[model samples]
Target chain A: MSVRVVVRTFSELCITVGAVIVLFVVYVLFWTGVKADTAMDDQIAQLEEQWAKGSASAGPGDPGSARGPGAAAPKAVAYEDGRPFAVMYIPRLGFTWNKPVLEGTRTKTLKKGLGHYASTARLGEPGNFAVAGHRRTYGDPFKDFPRLRPGDPVVLTDGTSWFTYRIDTRPYRTLPDDTAVVDPVPEKSGYTREGRYLTLTTCDPEWGHSHRLIVWAHLDETQPVEAGKPKALRR
Target chain B: MYGFIWRHLPGNTWIKALISLVLVLATVYVLFQYVFPWAEPLLPFNDVTVDNQ
Candidate 1:
């Protein structure tokens, strides 16, 4: 072959190979993302449905008969009872990690709730019921946590009973520490210390963990399973 | 602009088809291998925990 013709063929071959690689990368980055998103959405929706049904292990009982002002019903099952204490549904962000939320952060519990402080307080108590969760790993359970706003429901069910709370605040300015986030009552003057509350804590900045994100809510209402059931479980 | 056309030249039909095929295979492999596994845990996976272990 002539020198110029040989060089031209070699150049075209290089171009064709490079184009193939570029196209491959684009398909991996773009189309792969599209498919993953679709699959994740469908799976989340299905799991949310499963969460709506009353837990398989929950025995029939009147869950809220004992609940008075700041009174919690007898905890039917221990944190390790394998019964899900709460049905954490975040519709806006599409989260339905229905694993058992351990009441204490043991090695096993922390693995699920990220971390737990037993000394802090118990649920529906006067002190902090502090819990933590990983921001990125382990299913990224609370990755879209920042999307939570005031008035979102945080539902907690103790197998036989269910409790509902409304998201009260997302305070970024309270303090650099986690104490205020999990505090039982308002440290400030205007806030009342009488109502039952639920606080959710997770690592902040979405995938990045520069700080902690605290989502707090107050008990809106409660009922035993025989009385009023959550709309998700009604069907 | 001398180097622009040199970089932008279209390939022959056979080369173009080969390039597209490689792209499709690579995409399929990535979706099945890395992306699918990383995203699977987000879905329900038969509740295997340490207690079960």
Candidate 2:
């Protein structure tokens, strides 16, 4: 081949090789990210189990316990499917994922557990107990979150404590700011009610977050820890 | 003509393919098993406090 032709061919080959390497890197990054997420789920589950037991045994009055005044209650244990960790369930969405919510609804927690809004409502209260999670990433734990119809059950079990709530009105329109969903009252009206409410938040689209989707539920009942099966086995 | 020390570099497609496959497998195994576990502690958010610790 002529030198010019040879150089052109070499340049094309270099570009092709570079493209392949780029594609491989992207694939590996995505795969590793997913693997990391799966590992996180397992870790959260394990942490939930440990936290549940530790909280249960320590009791509210215990010196070294993490339970707050509201955290001391014992109910039927609940665990997620992939790991031996406790999860709060929303029977309406059939939402089952890991628990002991994290701060700011970080991507990692949303990956493992429902990210409870740190500033707002308590676990079992008469106000909104808002939780934010990813709609697609981290196994899409909240993939069905927005589909939760009114009257569907939302359950949260801390291995010894199980709290059930039913889907209520999901009146508010979609928004981007997550904090707005858990505002003291409806963002548009600023209206607050006395009844216990559960708010499930996820990305609007099935696999992405062009908008925010929410499912609202009302408290049905709180069951005792001794009334249900051991959460460890369930996990 | 001088004798070249590193003689023929065999071009074996099968060997190249096998090596690529082995690399991919090793990557998967390490990512899923050892590397993932090792990287768990590096997760900053994993360690948190909900209440008075």
Candidate 3:
């Protein structure tokens, strides 16, 4: 090819590549957020429908919550992989800020909503209930993660009960391999005993994952759904 | 690579440019709806878990 033609072709290729990169950015920032918001809404609707079905089939004396205080604790529902079982609300994020919590931390599972660490304890249990969410993309569920502070409450509901957990520490940054942050008693969480705790993790630096930001919380109180919103959730 | 496609168009320059623009828009749509979702799992930047295993 002539030198001028070759130069034109090279410049054209560069321009096309640049356009593609810009399109990719748009896909990540705008399109993915739009899609994730819809997915989260669908998940919440599905969970609500399931819960309604569950309650409709049971008698008045059922739901375990109607039982006396000295009775056995409510049985935890088995969380299915990739399925949403709970909705978490963080007032610190915003009054309208809520996200469905799905089982498993797989990449696909997280795209839809926050994912629970399958190895961690189930919600409201006497162990660390760990969860993960994206920091910058896929709706940026934890985009304001750094705003979390000690004493802030994270409320979650699993159809039958509302569990409120109060933050125990500010955001803790560590490498992704520091799996101990989700342990029954997280090493850095400053807890010396087992308890009903919540661990929230998201990627650090907003745009990168070289590190993680963690917020640890302990169960403050739990009440049956029929009791209205929990004290922490009250306006 | 793009030069071949531009040369093979069966129309004059203006028509070829219009067809190229349509093709580019179609490619972008395909990339967003299918290619990106498929390729996203293969990338690690979205990972937020401590135990990747």
RMSD of 2: 8.9
- State the lDDT of candidate 1 residue by residue for A1-235, as single tens digits: 6897778778977976686566555543454445434534544454445445634444444534566533655543344322224444444455343333544543234334334344445554555454455445444556667777886766655434566667777634333343555556745312476556666666555544345566667767666545666653342
By DockQ, the better pick of 1 and 2 is: 2
Candidate 3: where is the Cα deviation over 4 Å?
A: A59-75, B1-7, B11-18, B39-44
How would you encode candidate 3's per-residue C-alpha lDDT over A1-235 as one tens digit per residue? 7898889889988998898888887888798899999999999999999989877875454644463311224555588999999999999999889999999998889989999999998888878999999998789999999999999999998887788899989999999899999999998999999888999999887888789999999988787889999777778
Candidate order (DockQ): 3, 2, 1
Docking verdict class for candidate 3: medium
Weakest 10 consecutive residues, lDDT, candidate 2 chain A?
Answer: A76-85
DockQ for the candidates, in order: 0.07, 0.08, 0.55
Clashing pairs in 3: none
Deviation from native of the Cα of residue B1 in model 2, angstroms: 30
- Please list all clashing residue pairs in model 1, or write none if there are none: A63-A224
**Candidate number with the higher TM-score (2 or 3):** 3
Q: After superposition, how far is residue A136 of candidate 3 from its true place, in Å?
A: 0.9
Q: Per-residue lDDT tens digits of candidate 2, residues A1-235? A: 6797677767877975675556445433455457546665666667666876776786754344433223534443432333333366544444244434444455444445556666667666557777766555344556565456666666776454567776666534475644555654544333456556767666655643446666676666665555573332244
lDDT of 3 by residue, B1-53 (tens): 68889999878999999999999889988988898887766655586888874
- Candidate that would win on lDDT: 3
